[model samples]
Target: MLHGQSNAWAIDYDNVYNDNNLPEDAHWVRTIGAMHVYNRPAMYPEAENTNWYVASGKAPDIRGGIQLVGNGMVGVLGLNIGLNLVASQNVPIAIINGAGGGGAIASYQKNDSGLNAAYGRLQHRLEASGLKLHIKAFIWNQGEGNAGDAVSDYKNALYQLYKNLSSDYTFEKFYLVQTPPGCSASSGHQTVREAQRQFAAEHLAVKIITRHGFPENPLFDGNYFLSDACHYHAHGYEMLAEWISNMAKYDFYNGTVDYQAPQLVRVIRESGKSLSIEFDKPIAVQPDLKVDGIVYSVKDQLFAINSKKIISISELKVDSKNNKILRITFKGKRLTKGAVITYVLGDTYPDTKEPYRGPWLVDADTGVGAVGFIKTID
Candidate 1:
């Protein structure tokens, strides 16, 4: 099962660089808005009009089965990849896409409204499918809409959604795709990300895939977005599909999967020139780790650190008492009032192959790092 908002529904398979054909054994059903439900077999074409008006198996366009509607690329690719992996072991598979473009987490609660009113149409599809078939996993790729929501509210709402779905169906595992770093307008992304991190940590059956390094657009540079900087291109979807398929295979086969990211909890100043950076989990700091910062004249003001004098770290050590804390001492004048320090992970040593340039501080086991942090002196 697949569910989420626009990013989950956006499709750009036609623009994919390499050959990304659908699997022969895969089939899908989609709930369109509140009124229409379309079913399709595998190997559906991309040229057909993906609307209720189109008939299945029509010439010039194969209409039956799942058609790429709007920017709905990744869901189909992900499903194909998953089913292919399962079929390699002689297992037959089908998928249900119960997603709505622009759908928010709040809209899909037990009591629904808008396109999802009365528990929305997704529930209807799930109920109908649940009667005869058993669900394997619930793959969720949402949270872009909830980027502005309070962390607690988003967490609670997501938990409720999980509970409601579990009660309605029997699924072995739940996979959540961490929100992409596209929604910069919403300041609550970090909060939501933290909420997701915490929730996944507490739940054993839940797994989260990271979207840390995915480019907003693959074609051009200069902040080029896939589509409006929020959605992804076909290649992006394909990469996401690769992650989904791998996770699905592991979970389906009862294999243990890593689903944790290093979390930055706090940054405390121990002295005028020293600071203690804490993480929720233990981290392995690379020997090549470097720190570059600007001495801000005013606190809470954002500026281009490149133009200012760069402060170098005199010492960076792991706390012997607590592995989660990093003792950082910089060689400079004591930090005074109204001075701010900032450092971005992966900026100095960016890995083109890594996700988000690989987080600065990574877990020894998973190599996922805590989110970057900033400190402002009072």
Candidate 2:
């Protein structure tokens, strides 16, 4: 199932901008409003009924609330990519699209009103499709409307959406697109983005499709926007579709997906003044922990040992035997028993070049941050 806002709906590809050409091999169905259904079958005897009809390029209006369709052009490039991925593996794919253009996360809760009512319709269509197709994944590309919402509120709402979907159906994985860099200057954008990052980091089943290295379309002179600064053009959509395909292919081929996050496992006292911090996974250590031939002092990188209190770290070294462990020596006062160390708390080190110095530890391979944790010396 594909859900979310305009991005998932492909609002940018409205009829005015481009034609919605149906792919020849694509076989899919879609729901219109609450009761009507439309199918775009690979072979046509064009299925039609009082409630069902054959879908055309422009049959189901983009403005219509909820829909389900075969993996065809259907405006949603991402869904098309998903369908193509399934087809490549010689499998049939059917998709249910429950998306609203300007919808917020709150609108899709268990019982939401207004345009968000699409969620209810989406559920009805899924139940109505008695094919008993095993759901593979729920592809979500939203969050722009909530760009101004508080991070905590957005996070909670997002979690609820995931829970709501899980309760409604059984699916293998959730593919969450790290929403585009919309209104980059908006505080809500950053908040929601960070919340998404943190959520994906903590949830094992949630696989995030990052937009980090995505390039702007050269057709737009490398500008991130298409016709509007908020949406993407054909080229941008193609790139995004490719990304979705890659992620889908990875998940489809392997029973398990790769998630890289440097998790803080525990903190052990090596001696009176030395401490060893262990992470759940191996990490990349900066070979040269020095700038301009001078070793960076513990005061420079070490943020806090216990309770946000700044303590000078006389020496800091990655353990020789275990790259996941970092050994630290205090300059003056030794850490007392039960001293809790906190690093990268909130968005503290906003400008730090080294991720290890920040509140969240970063995995070298994926550059994904580890969930921040508080560890007490034992």
Cα deviation of 232, candidate 1, in Å: 0.8
Off by over 4 Å in 2: 12-24, 27-74, 112-116, 131-133, 255-378
lDDT of 1 by residue, 155-263 (tens): 8988998898888778877887766455434343544665676667678888766665333343543122343555555556655665566566666665464434455
- lDDT, residue 96, candidate 2: 51
Pairs that clash in candidate 2: 28-70, 29-68, 29-69, 29-70, 30-68, 31-68, 147-188, 343-359, 344-358, 344-359
User: How many clashing residue pairs appear in each of the predictions shown?
Assistant: 13, 10
Overall lDDT per candidate, in order of appearance: 0.50, 0.54
Model 1, residue 128: C-alpha shift (Å): 2.0
- lDDT per residue as tens, model 2, 333-369: 5667788775433221223322122212344554444
